[model samples]
Target: MKISRTIHMTNSGRKHKTNKIKSIYNNMLAEFKRGEIGYSTIAILGQSCLGSIAVILLLMNDMPTMIKMVQLFLVTVFCMAFNGAVLAQLKSKITFDLLIATILLSACVIVTNLV
Candidate 1:
């Protein structure tokens, strides 16, 4: 009788599944660090306006309360991440303060919804 060995491959196989995603995220982070002031400003402002509009629309829509809350949380997280990236790029004191204020306001809204 001869013994044979067979290797089974999983979904990830030999490479980590998240390597591509991790590389992309790292590249984006590096770009943000080396981005210009004007570019960072434009991104921050544009994203702020868009996020605000999205939150407003979600609030006014006929969605369930839980769904609206989840949407709000996701929107707030995106807004904060954008602001953080801009702040990291520009290293501006004003951007830092704005980020803090945005977080506080989001927390207040969430609290109100929960209560």
Candidate 2:
């Protein structure tokens, strides 16, 4: 009986945690869709995601540092294109500051690695 009770509690606890995570994810998605978060925030976050993937790809290829930088730059540009398109679809204007910030960040990454 005690073993069965422990199993049931564990199952319920797992379900509770899963539901909580799902709720949080849904809320965040809703906010992004609603434009509650500004474009810069969204772009940075999107770029970060793409950048991580690019890093993983670069690692797997065992490429040179220069090549890795170039790949990262390309990934950053692709992320910008995607974010721009999404903002455009929502009729949101892309600002110069956001563009410059992302470009500078990408450049910094490449330049720092070159040193």
Q: Residues 1-115, candidate 1, lDDT per residue (tens digit)? A: 8776878768764755668877775675566555557656776776677667667766876758998888789778868876776766545444544554565555555445544
TM-scores for all predictions: 0.48, 0.34
lDDT of 2 at 83: 64
Report residue 40 deviation for candidate 1 (angstroms).
Answer: 0.4
Give candidate 1's whole-model lDDT. 0.65
lDDT of each structure?
Answer: 0.65, 0.57
Q: State which candidate has the highest lDDT.
A: 1
Span of 10 residues, lowest total lDDT, candidate 1:
90-99
Screening candidate 1 with a backbone cut-off below 3 angstroms (N, C-alpha, C), the clashing residue pairs are none
Candidate 1 ranges beyond 4 A from true positions: 1-35, 90-115
**Runs in model 2 with CA error above 4 Å?**
1-19, 36-63, 90-115
Residue 46's lDDT in candidate 1: 68
